[model samples]
Target chain A: MANLVNYYIQFIKRDLQLAVRQKHEFVLPLLFFVLILILFPVTVGPESGLLARLAPAVGWINLILSLLIALPRMFSEDYENGWLEQVFLAAVSPSFFILTRILSFWLLYCLPLVICSVLLVPFMSLPFDIWWVLAQTLFLGSLLVAALGSVASALLVASRKGSGVLALLLLPMLIPALIFGSAVIEAAQQSLPYLSPMLLLAALAVFCLTIAPVAAAQAIKINLG
Target chain B: MFKWLHPYAKPERAYALANRLYLWLWPLALIGLFTGSLWGLMFAPSDYQQSDSFRIMYIHVPAAIWSMGIYMSMGIAGICALVWQMRSFELSVLAMAPIGAVFTAIALFTGSFWGKPMWGTWWVWDARLTSELILLFLYLGVFALFYSFDDKRAGAKAACILAIIGMINVPIIHYSVEWWNSLHQGASITKFDKPSIAKEMLWPLLINIFSCLLLFIALTCYRFATELLASESHRKWVTKIIQ
Candidate 1:
């Protein structure tokens, strides 16, 4: 058990180290989030009320879309260089490798976006009271993205084209997370009971956590043969 | 558990089974469709309120229900394909996607037609309607995925994986949409009292629903046979059948 844990820890460490080496991989989604959220305020006119009203939804969508932007990059390197092939050849389980990859992705791709979303809370004219709810939902919601994104990245490994099919495959699956996460924000905005949506979001993330890695491993093996 | 049914796992047996079943199913489906449509369209009493507009429900409701039903079946077929590596089940997964998509489209069109008169709008983002739209998108995603692969087998497998994901997420999508809709709009959707459907209206509706199911299965069988032919075209049985 200790050996298994240590083995997976190295995979996670390797992935995080790779992200750290490229530092821009971490900054890209965050930059996209800020730039696009800024565009919304500028384009929609300077009205605080509309910006505040649109804040939760607009925030959630940009976060999701920017994460979509970061998706193809997630696996293209390892897939093209045959790193995945070497891992599978070593008889290391693909699911463990995939789960740790997703965990590091959550750290690199989703974590920064969630943190930046909290920082930009003021720019969107969001209610200060909703930040905690917003952050909690973003944190949970993006983990679901990492899970689903792992499956999609695995899928992309099999398919020939990189055209926006990743977005098509991942976006629809993320609707529940989007709806649940946004509900948490909106409920907090109105000061209504928000606990249920928050809990549901966590449940959803947990559910995806169990299924996605296995499914992703399956996708990889299907293509491998 | 599935050991006794092992014979049919061969592509030839599965194809022959579908071919034979479709032959019987076609007649039943046609008769049910003809009689049910005639009765529902002309003989079934017009609703007390909104009169004939409610008749659209006969088609709309059945299509709506079965779109969801076909999606469930596809999910099962997908599991069969991925887990058991059943080649025939893979054909069914591919065959069923377009059918499910068409059913979802019919439901949406009929729904808007009904909505125009009943709800005073051509469309509304009601929870059910929105979820149905999402279902249509899921079908399209599976359909598109299948075509995108060079190896049809790989395509089927990938599409099946997607179908499984959709099945898991569909309920969560529906519930979350419902919760979100409730937050925006307060109980504005008109409720249909199901037990109140009259016997005259109910009978034809039931008939139509049954006919639609038979027709859907028949079409799936037909599609399965044709696709099985394509996939097995190089085999002796296929050449023999072609002869």
Candidate 2:
């Protein structure tokens, strides 16, 4: 049991180290998130009511799409570096490796977006009171994104052309998150009871957290073979 | 445990069994489908509210049910293939996807036709319809993922993972959409009242349901047989059968 914990820590450390080595990979999704925030107003025109109405959807979508941008790199880099093979052959189980990878990804890819979204909330002219709800939704919502994207990344690890198919596979599964995340903010904006949607989002995040890694690990084994 | 049934788990035995089953399934499917459609279209009473337009229910509802039913069956097959390493179940997943996709499409198309008259629009973001649309996309994802890999078995395993993921998501999608729909439309979709299903209307619907299910089974068996043959084409058994 101690050995498994050590292996888990080592995997997380290695992944965080790799993430830190290429700082831009971590920053790119954040940058993309910011860019979309700027671009939506330009494309849709600078009307505060429209932007306010669109804010929840725009924020949720950009977060999910930016997560997609970060996803393909999740497993492909390890596979290309031949690190995944070594990790699989080690005493650490694939599920643990995958779970740790998803955790690091949620930290690296999702956490920054959650923080940035809080800052971006004012720019969209959404009510300041809803900011906390928006932040909460973004935080929980993107964990589900990270978890589902992990499975997509694991499955597509060996494919040369993967990003397109990954989006197709992951986006449909991400709809619940999209619905709940945006709905929470929408509910809050309308002064309705928003707790239900928030709880649903957290539930979804937990469900994905438990199931995705094992499925992803199985996918990785299949892709490896 | 049915120990005596173990031999049927072999691909050759399964393939042979599927082939034998096809003989009865195909003719029964045809008869049921033709009679059910004819009876439902002509004999069954028109809905008092919608009249002739409601006849589309015979196709739309059955197609909707089978599309979801096929995906659920395929998901179960996927579990067997991935967890137990069953080749026949792998073949079952491969065979079921396209059929499920087609049924989903038929449901969507017929749904639009039905909606145009009932709702005075070609589309509504109703919960059932949106959920079925998402189901179509899920089926397409499995197809795309399965074919993307150069290694057939690897592709199957990858697709199986997706199938399992989708199975978990299906109910969540359905419930979420239902909630969203009710929030937006508010009690407009309570048309599925079980007590309102008169005996005259219910019998034809039941007949059509059975026919559609039989058709799905027949199509899946046929597709599974051909898929098995194609995959095992280089084997001695395949060559002997061809000879």
Candidate 3:
């Protein structure tokens, strides 16, 4: 048990150190996320109510997209360098590696989105009360996105096809999260009980957290074979 | 039972069985489709409310049901392939993708046509249509994933993982959509409650359902056989058959 824990910790520390060294991977997606927020108001016109109404959806879409943009980095580096095959075949289980990657991704990619959305919320004219709800939804939803997106990244890591197919495969599964995240925000906007959708998103996060690593491990194994 | 079923674990035996089944399935499918369409389009009494627009239900409903059915079978084939490493099951998964896509497209198109006159709009964000749209996307994803790989076996395995994942998600997607629909659209416009279906209408629909299933089986079997043959052309049995 201690050995397994040590392996997981070591994996996270290694990936985080890589993430710090290659700050561009983190900065590029962050820039894209900020650019999406800035561009939406310009494209849709600066009407505050419209922006408020559209903010939840636009934010959620951008959140998923930004996460997606960073997804290729999740496995491609290891895959390209051939370390992924070594890890898969190594004494350490691939699932732990996948889980570590998912955790670090949520920290580096998803965590930043949640923090920045705090600043963007009031700028978009959304209700303050719903900000808390949006925060809750984004936190959970980002974890789900990271977990699910890692699976897609693993599957596509070895394939020559780029992010288009990855998006095609990932986006549909992301819908429920998108729907519930925005729905809870909308619910909070109307002062209705938003707890149900929040709970549902939690369930989805838990479900993804459990299944994605195993599936990702299997996908990596298949790709390696 | 295990003894009887053991031979089919071999791809050669399975392909032969699928080939034999296709011989019966295609003709039966054609006859049933024609008969069902005739009965549905002409003999079935018009819906009291919907009248003739409801005749589209025969095609739409069957296509919709089979779209889901094909995915379910694909999921089963995926599990079999994963568990036993059966090449036949992998080929079946590949063969079923286009068939499922076509059926899903039929369902969506016929659904919109039926919707135009009934709901006064060609599209609605209701649960059934929304879920069907997602199913279409799932089918496209399967196709995209399959063709993206250089190694066909690896592609099939990856697509199988996706199929199994998708199969698990379908029910959750359906339930979530249902909840979303109920909350947003109060009392669905697309509810085809089985208990409410009249006998006259139900009979023709049932026949069409059977016909559609036969059509799926026939098409899938033929496609699987062709795929099997192509992949196995250098093998002894394929050589003998070709000779």
Candidate 4:
């Protein structure tokens, strides 16, 4: 299936190329994330203990929100430019394309943000040792967000609804990710056994990853029809 | 496959069936509801611990169970709709959503009324309560999704997919919320264990549960009929019925 692989790679390259051309597609989420990081420290006051205690929560919650900003990237371009019928049809296995498209968006949207978040961990008043655990959980949480967000975005293509409905359909599903992601951080801080939450996060991400692409492919087709 | 299901798959047959079932269902639901509430509220001896406040359990327990049950049924309807492309199931999904949302709301309110006396507050982030709140949100989302599309069929498909996804999520969410936090009591009744309630209290609660299910079915049948008629007014069968 070399042809299939090529088509998948081509679609991902196109998504990345478009983001590079716009410059801001990826930058905006990063900017929003950094702004949230700054806002928390200043607004919540500069007390180290309090900031440290609140940091994991503030960071995880804002990261989920920032990722929400990046959600439409998964399928919106193909949808808006009417390339979906062609691009999705060109690939015999549309789920492959769907997976890659979300993967690229996740790479561009979540990776840099997660790395930046880890780099700034000291500023969030977290222990330096937490970097590894923090990075692991952030990656998993963002993966889950990308998967769920892509499905929601695909559904939106059919519905033509506003962002409010998207948020309504989405936020409730994000709860477990929020709970476990923050738990991972808190566990790290306390030096308690953090493996359970991280494993849980990994399970969530993988589960969504498997299901989202297929469901989204169906949604795009149904919506486009 | 499922050859017997073919005739009932037709909107006309399903609508007529629902209409016939409604006649029986509504009266039974009403009579059962009245009897169950009277028995549970007035006849059941007051709980030694909760006393009079425990009386609210009649409403709260049934509403909570059926709120979840309704969503599960919607999920089943969704899967059938997607698999068979059954428009009747789609209509049923839409018809049941508001009622599901209402049941969830009733559960929450009755819960808090009991909680204020027992838990010393109107609300807590307990596992059951939070998940119930989330279920309400799911109902709102499911209902809203159905109307969001320019293409009604497309909207139904998308909402069906979402309901299925939500059905899958509810248990995961329930357990996760449990792991995250909980303060409510364990199940008051169970299949294996002797029900934790007094025998006298348990019978009325059981009656209330079944009556609530009947009420839900009766109401959904009524609404499903209306949905079918509204969507297919120009169809000959619908027109003939109208005349």
Q: Clashing residue pairs in candidate 4, if any?
A: none
Whichever of 1 and 4 has more lDDT, that candidate is 1
Best by lDDT: 3
Look at candidate 4 and tell me the lDDT of residue B10: 83
Mind giving the per-residue lDDT tens digits that candidate 3 earns over B122-185? 9989888899999999999988998888888899999999999999888988888778778775
User: What's the DockQ of model 3?
Assistant: 0.77
Write down the worst ten-residue block by lDDT for model 4 chain B: B183-192
When 2 and 4 are scored with TM-score, the better candidate is 2
Off by over 4 Å in 1: A24-26, B1-4
Q: What's the residue-level lDDT of B229 in candidate 3?
A: 90
- Model 1 per-residue lDDT tens digits across residues B76-130: 9999888888888888998899999999999999999988988899899888898
* Selected candidate, larger DockQ, 1 vs 3: 3
Candidate 2: residue B116 lDDT (0-100): 88
Best by TM-score: 3
List candidate 4 segments past 4 Å from native: A119-123, B1-3, B182-195
For all predictions, the C-alpha RMSD in Å is: 2.0, 1.8, 1.5, 2.8
Question: How is the predicted docking of candidate 4 categorized under the CAPRI scheme?
Answer: medium
- Model 4 chain A poorest 10 in a row by lDDT: A157-166
Worst lDDT 10-window in candidate 3 chain B: B186-195
Sort candidate 3 into its docking category.
medium
What TM-score goes with each of the models? 0.94, 0.95, 0.97, 0.94
DockQ for all candidate structures vs. native: 0.65, 0.77, 0.77, 0.74
User: For model 4, what is the alpha-carbon lDDT of residue B38?
Assistant: 99
For candidate 3, list the clashing residue pairs, or say none.
Answer: none
